[model samples]
Target: MAVDPDKAVLQELARRNPGEPFVMLNLLRFAADGRASYEEYSRRAAAFLRQYGGELLYAGDGNEALVAEEGQAWDAVLLVRYPSREAFSRMVTDPGYREISRLRSRALAEAVLQPTTPWTRRAG
Candidate 1:
């Protein structure tokens, strides 16, 4: 049977935070062999996020990120925190962020962005 990757990720997240209003942002950046510039791209991405008052909770690279049950085929992953989903969207659509995104696109082979909004469940 084929596993629904999105479901799996969401289930894993629900197990961790059963009743919390949180958003999970997953970034997948694949780099060309021996030509990937993750270091530079990550620095710029980090800076762009910082400008919007984004708090980076965690950062993972190809090595460590590969352990995600989905496996780390990506060059990097970043976990960031924001007050709300609208806020996150605003940050991405910001004019300054658009310019930074251009540089990011050039530094990676591919990028996948996932935004997850969680529901808070009340316990009996």
Candidate 2:
């Protein structure tokens, strides 16, 4: 399970310009008594998000899964939308944001951070 994205992932993200906003889907598994830590991180991250033109779309604790594998249910889920990939990249690389991320790292047992690009169906 990856808690953070690596340089390779960053590089790949950098190469893509979908010409649309990017929203990250966070699937989280908390460590023992880790919600508090994640809350701290989220509190700290709120400022950075505003500074970088990003917003927390939704954040909620997960519950029953209507469909999925037995172990596939997440402890929490978050949707964060960024103005652009460059803005997101900048935020991730920011020294201040990195410090805030420490709390998030400590709070999570595992996480899947997937960036979603909005797209509309093309009809002919």
Candidate 3:
């Protein structure tokens, strides 16, 4: 299971929308005894998030899925909005942030970090 973004994907993410504000969807599955580590990571990462204009809109523990295939429920979910893709890229690459990122890596058994573009309303 993939837990972190690679350089290639981060580059691709920046190239796609370097200037547009976007939200990141985080689907996390914790490793054994991982939640505590992840909480610590979140605490440390808050400073970086503020430094780079990232806002955590929502975070919640997952409950039983009302509708989903087997093995589809996540352990936690987070919606984080960034000023732009570049800001997100910068945050991840920052040396300070990188130092603490290991906590996140050890905390998750698997993760999905997806960038989301808001939909525009269509004129009727």
Best by the TM-score measure: 3
TM-scores of the models, in the order given? 0.57, 0.93, 0.98
Q: How does residue 20 of candidate 3 score in lDDT? A: 92
What lDDT, from 0 to 1, does candidate 2 have?
Answer: 0.90
Would you list the C-alpha lDDT of every candidate in the order shown? 0.56, 0.90, 0.97
**lDDT at residue 92 of model 1 (Cα atoms):** 62
Model 3, position 17: C-alpha lDDT score: 61
Q: Per-residue error at 83 for model 2, in Å?
A: 0.8
Worst ten in a row by lDDT for model 1: 1-10
Q: Alpha-carbon error at 57 in model 2, in Å?
A: 1.0
The full ranking of all candidates by lDDT, starting with the best, is 3, 2, 1
**What's the CA RMSD of model 2 in angstroms?**
1.4
Model 1: pairs clashing at backbone N, Cα or C within 3 Å: 66-72
**Every model: Cα RMSD to truth:** 8.1, 1.4, 0.5
Across residues 1-124, which tens digit of lDDT does each residue of candidate 2 receive? 6798998898778679834578999999999999999999998999999998999999998999999998999999999999888888888899999988999999999999999977888997
> Model 1, 18-102: lDDT tens per residue?
5443445656555454224545555676776666556777777656543566644666676777555445555666687666665
How high is the lDDT of residue 106 in model 2? 92
Question: Which stretches of candidate 3 lie above 4 Å from their native place?
Answer: none
Shift in Å, residue 21, candidate 1: 6.7
